[model samples]
Target: MDIMDIARRKERPAHRVFSAGFYGGSWDHDVRSVLGKAPRGGADVGEVLSTIAAVEPHDTEAWPTAWIALGDRVGAVAARAAERGHRVSAARAHLRAANYLAVAVNALAGRTDAEDRLQAVFRRHRAEWDGFTAQSGWDVRVLDLPYGDGTMPGLLFRPDAAGSPRPTLVMVNGSDGSISGLWCEGAEGALERGYNVLLFDGPGQQSMLLDQGVVFRPDWEAVLTPVVDVLLGRDDTDPAAVVAYGISQGGYWLPRALAFEHRFAAAAVDGGVVDVSRSWWAHIPDSLRKAYDKGEKEKFDRDMALGFKLPGGKAAERTWAFRARPYGTRGYAETLDAVSAYSLTDALCARIETPLFVAAPHNEEFFPGQSQELAAAVPGAEPVEFTAAEGADRHCQPLARELTEQRVFDWMDERLGR
Candidate 1:
C-alpha cells in the first residue's frame, strides 16, 4: 500500500470561512501562484496581502469584485512599465496581473456563461498573459487543436534552447482549472529544464464547457488522440519522448489517456484518482446514497437539493453549482450515474503500458489511497507517497509545488532518457 494510507487527512468544516482541501478548497490557494514575492519585483508582497484582506471568505457575490479590484491595480502597474520601455518589468507585472484576474474569474464560480462579465475578466487574463510571454523570451503559441467538429484552445511553450527535436511535456488541466492556471503550476519549471510544454482544455474543461457546452466524457482517448496528433506533428517536438503530465483531476485524465494512447513515452499524475465515484460517494451521506441506490430519482433529488443551500449564503450556492458542471447531470441521480462511469475498469488499467508515475501526497483530502489503488492495478506503475512531514501533503501539493514539480519532472526525465 502507498504511504498515503497511513496519513489520514484532517477534517474541516464544510462551509467555513476558509477552506484548504481540493473539493471545496479556498480561493486563497491561488495566492500560491505569486507566493514569496513572485514576478520578481513586479508584485508587491504587501499589496497582494492587502488585496486578499479586503474580502471576506466564502462571499461569492463579493469574490469577483475584490479580485478585479486587485487585478486592475496590478494591471495599471503593467501599463506604466510598458510605457516606460521596461519590457522585463512590464512582462512580470502583466503576468502577475493576469494571474490575479484569472483567479478573479475563477472565483465567480457558477457563472460559466461566456456572455457574463466573468468571461470578460478571463479574456483580459489571456490578453495580459500573452503580453507577458511575448516579452519574457518564451516562444509561446496560441493555437486551436482540431477536436470533434470545432477546435480546442491550446498554449504550446517551446523552450528558447536550440535543439533539433526537444522533449515535450503535455500538461492536462483538472476538474476546475484552466490553461492559464497550468502556467504557475508546473509549465514554467518544465520550460526551464529545456522541455517543451503544452496546455489545452479538453472536453468539459474551461472554455470548452463554458463557451462550447462540451461536457466531459469517460472515453478520454477521443480527446487525447487529437492532442497527440498536434504535438508530434510539430517539427520541434521529439516524437519519441513526449510525456503526459496531468494535474488535480487530470490525475485520472492523464493515466486514462495513456491507457489508450500508448505513443507517449511516459505519464505522471500529481494525485492519481482511481475512481471519481468513490470520492464523491465518500462525501455524501449514507441516507442519500441509499435513496439514490434504490433508484428513487425524484426523492433523491429533493433530499439533496437543500445540501447546496448552506448557511454561508450565496458562496455556498455558487460553490456547489461550480462543482456540478463536471457530471453534466440535471439532478442527483444523474450525477451519480455520470460519475459511476468515470472509472478505469481493471481491464483498462492492465492495458496501460507506458511508464507511469503517481504522486500521492499525505493529507490528501480529495482522493486519498486512490494512487496506491492505481499503482496496484496497473502493471509497473510506480506510486510515490509524499508525507506531511516533508511539507508536501495537500492535494497536488499546491503550496509545495516546487517539490512536486522536481519529483515529477525528474521521474519523467529518467523515463524519457533525458
Candidate 2:
C-alpha cells in the first residue's frame, strides 16, 4: 500500500505551543522533542504542557527559563541515581536532562553574555550524557575530526554485534542541530539496523559555530570532503558500502558534496533545498521585494532593519539574529548575500554520479517543492514523499522518524547490498 494514502491528523491543535507563528524556528518541534523523549525518561508530557502554558508565543527570554528549570530537576535525579549506582536509571535521566538543556540552548536569540548561562548549563548536561553513555555499555566513542586549523567534534557508534566491518552511515547535521540531537533524529535507528553510525558537527552546526567561530560557507563540499576522508580511513567502515545522510540544511549540503566527492556509495537527504535565498526572499514582505527589484538595496536594508524593530517583530528579530551569527555577518543584508550564494545548480546536480535518495514531505514549510525540483535536476534521483495523511508531513519527519528511518535505510540497504 502507498504510504501517503494512509489517514492521519488533518488539523493542528489550536492551543498547541507556537502554533500561530515562526518563533525560534518551530515551537512544535520543541514540544514534539519533549514528548518524544518521554519513552526515554526525558520528559513528563503533562508537566511540559503545563510549562508551555505559562509562556507566550515568541517569548525567548521566558522559554529558556521554563525548560532549563525542568532540565535542572532532571539533572538532580540523574546525579542521585548515579550516586546510588543505578546505571540504567542514571543514564535515562541524564539523557533526558541533556535533551531539555539542548532545547533551552537552541532557543537562545543570539551570542551574548546573557546566553552564557544557558550554554554552560547545556554543556554540563552534555557532560552528564557522556558519562552516562560511557557507563551504559553502548559502543559509542567521542572523536574529533581534523579540519582546517581546528577539529570538528563527533560521536561514532558501533553496533553491538561486531565481527566483519559493517556498512557505516555517516550523518551530517543541519544548520542548528547538535551531534547529540542527531542520535534521536536517526543515529539510534541506524545503530539498531547494525550499521556503524558517525554523527558530526560541520561548519555552522553547534560547537563549530558557537565555539570554534567557524562561520558557514556556501561551498559545503569543502567541509564534507575532509569528513569523508577521515571516516573512510577508519578500520570499522566498509569503504564499498559507506553512505552519507544529511538532514535539514544538510539536504543541500550533502547533495552539493556528492557532486564532487564520489567516494561515497550513496547519499540521502531528509529534505532537499535547491536555493535557500529564494526561500528567504519569498518570506520577505512584498514591499521589501519591490525595493530589491527596483535596485534600491540600501532602502530595502533599512526597511528590513525597521521591520525587526517594530511591534510584534520579535520573532523575525530572533530568527534573523540567529541566522546571521552562523555567517559572521554584521547584519541581515550580508547574511542574505551569504544565503543567496547557497544554491545547487542543475549543472552541479547533474554532475553527481552517486545514487541519490531525496525525501520530500508534502507539508514542508521552509523549502516546499525543493525535493522534486532537485530530483528532476539530478539524473536517476529517487524522490520519495511523506504526506500529511501519513502524519509525517512536517520538516524532517520528526513525528514519523521510525518510518523515515525505515524507508531511508531500506533504500540504502538495497543500493549498497547491506
Candidate 3:
C-alpha cells in the first residue's frame, strides 16, 4: 500500500510505535537511514516537509528519526514561527512530525539509548499500547539455535492461560522484523486468546541480522524444527496441538516447516509464497510494473534479491536497484531471482490431511491469484481465499484481518478439539 494512504487512515495525533508497521519493514533501520539522507537537500519549508514525509517507517521507531532527520529544519521553522508569535503553527508541525514518527520508527525495543526516551514520549502521548495489554501469561524468550555453521534466534511467548498446558502457536515471524514482532496485530491476538505463541527470528529476521548476523534463508523449516522441540517440552503447551501459522514471509516459512515436519496439528498460512519466486515478485505492487517494464530501476530489485533465498540456495545481496521499494526486502530483483526457484504451490498442496488456510488478496500486483495459487498447491486444503482490495491501511489487508483471525482460530479450534 502507498505510505501516504496509511498515514491518512491512522489519523493519530503523534508519531508512535504502533504506527511503525505503516512505514513497512525495519522501522528502526529505515528511519535512521532516510532521516540521515533528508537534511543534505532540504532548503526551505517545503523541502523539510517533504523530507519528513518521505522516510515512512513501518513501525514505531519512525517518530524520533522523523524529528531527528529534519530536527534542524523543523526547529528552524518552529523558531521562525515562534518569533512571529505563531506558536500554534510551530507546535502543530512539531507535534505532527513527532506524533507520526512515534509509530513509524521502532524506538521501544531498539538498541539506541533513545529507546527509553522515545518510549516515554509515546507513553506520555499515545495513551496506551492498543495492540497488547494483557500481562503475558507466558513470557517471550529468545533462544539461539545453532545451524550448519550459523544460528537464528527462536522467540517463545508463553500464554498466561491457567490450564493444563494449552495449545501452542509457533508463530514464525515475517522476514523483516525480529521476534519481538509477536507484538503485531495477529500474534498479539493469538496471545490474548490464550495460546502459547512462539515467535521465531530465524534467518533474515531482525535478531538474526542485528544480533546473530544472519540473513534470510529458504530452508526455514530446518530452523523451526529445533525450536518446535523447545516449545513441545514446555509445561504450558499441549504437544499434540502444536499448530503453526505463517504470515507474509512466515507463509513461506511455516509451509516449509510443515513440509519437513508432519507433526503440526494444522497450518494456517496467509499471503505466503504461492511459489517462492512468483510470490516474491508479487511483493512488488502494480504501480512499479511500468518502471520495471521500462528497465528503469535496479536498486529495489537488488536489495530484494540480496536478502532473498530459495530452498537449498544461498541469500545473495541484490545485484541491481528498483524504482519503487518493496516494504520488507530492499533487493527486489535479487530476491525474485532467488524466489524464481519458487514452487511452493505444489509443495503446500501435497498434504491434504494438513488443514491449510490460504488467504489471497484481490489486487496483488506481482503474484495475482495468490489464494488460487495456494489453493492450486493444496487441492482440498481448506482454502480461505477472499477478494480483498488493497485498503486505505497497508499492503496486507486490515479488512481481511478480522475475518482471517476468526476463520483461523475457529478452524484450529475444531482440529485441536479445543
Every model's TM-score: 0.87, 0.89, 0.58
Flag clash pairs in model 2.
none
Candidate 2 vs 3: which has more TM-score: 2
lDDT of 3 by residue, 1-418 (tens): 3666566547654464333323443333333322222221112335434655665533234545554455434445555665676755554444333333333333433333454564454443222111112122345555666566765555556654354687788776655432322344356567767787766556655445444446566766578777777767777778888888876657767776666777788888766565655533444556555556566568545433444455312211121221112222434544454555435646454754567776665554334566566666765666664553323122244334555567778888888887
**Root-mean-square deviation of each candidate, in angstroms?**
6.1, 5.7, 12.7
> What is the alpha-carbon lDDT for the whole of candidate 3?
0.52
Error of 3 at 222 (Å): 0.9
Number of the top-ranking candidate, with TM-score as the measure: 2
Q: Please give the CA lDDT of all the candidate structures.
A: 0.75, 0.77, 0.52
Q: Write the per-residue lDDT of candidate 2 for residues 1-418, one digit (tens) a residue.
A: 1232122112334454333322235676767656655643456667677877787655667888888887788878888988999988887777777777777777774535456785686576577667567656578767888778888888778887363678889898888775556777777778778888887778877777767778888787787788778777877888898898999889888899888999889889998989878767876898888887787878888999899788867677776776677778875566777788889999999999989999999878778899989999999999998986786776787667767878999999899876
C-alpha lDDT (0 to 100) for residue 375 of candidate 2: 91
After superposition, the stretches of candidate 1 with alpha carbons farther than 4 Å from their true spots are: 1-25, 28-45, 111-115, 161-163, 309-316
In model 2, the runs with Cα more than 4 Å from the true position are 1-25, 37-47, 111-113, 161-163, 293-295
- Residue pairs that clash (backbone atoms under 3 angstroms), model 1: none
Error of 2 at 275 (Å): 1.0
Candidate 1 achieves a global lDDT of 0.75
Rank by lDDT (best first): 2, 1, 3
